[model samples]
Target: MRRPRPKRGERRIDAATDHLAQYGFAKPQIRNVIHDLLQLYGRDGWVFLEEGSYPMVLNRLLEEQAQQDQDEDGSTITDE
Candidate 1:
């Protein structure tokens, strides 16, 4: 049997999957982030980000979150 076509919203998600996976986001986390983004921006405004800005913005946010997590837990996270 052939696979069904992915929805429009999923196109944006599929585009981001590899990038997010490289940053250690599992499927659930990626979905949660997408959901949060949708909630933050509202449906009409929730277009996929520009390619040039996406990675930079996402990296900064992830770094900020990592710092906050480390600060709260008082643990040192070494980068590989």
Candidate 2:
């Protein structure tokens, strides 16, 4: 017997996982992130992923993380 086909949501998850993995996210974390994004954006998240804007989302997430890390490290200077 062959495996059953995945539904649209499942396919979306799979695609998102693959794309996110390229950005160094682990499978488990990717799933959780996607779930959270879905909850946060609602239907708009699905449209964003379908339109290939998820990569942009991931990039922004990474940039934020880097900024946070930099701030924590006190490498970011504040001008008086």
Candidate 3:
């Protein structure tokens, strides 16, 4: 069966999926990551119900959360 076309509001998510596919993500992986992102930041008004434009917004939210966590712990996760 063919996949259903994305609705109008899902264009950004669709675009993000296409972008991730170029980087070697399979459909399932993309869907999983997007779901995780949505679960984490879906209620912050970053995601538009009328347009799929949350990837960049979610990235910023993740960065901010990481920084806040580091600040609260008084330490940072250094790459070794």
The candidate maximizing TM-score is 2
Give the clash count for model 1: 0
Between candidates 1 and 2, the one scoring higher on lDDT is 2
TM-score of each: 0.51, 0.57, 0.42
lDDT by residue for model 3 (1-80), tens: 99998796476667766655664546566656566656876745334522454455345445655787899999967899
* lDDT (CA) per prediction: 0.64, 0.73, 0.59
Weakest 10 consecutive residues, lDDT, candidate 3? Answer: 45-54
Indicate which candidate wins on lDDT: 2
Per-residue CA lDDT of candidate 1, range 34-56, in tens? 66666766775334543564553
RMSD of 2: 5.2
lDDT of 2 by residue, 1-80 (tens): 99899886568788877777887877676777677778888966788755754865586567667887998998976799
Which residue runs does candidate 3 get wrong by more than 4 Å? 1-10, 43-80
Where is model 1 more than 4 Å wrong at Cα?
Answer: 1-10, 46-53, 56-68, 71-80
Ranking by TM-score: 2, 1, 3
Q: lDDT: which is higher, 1 or 3?
A: 1
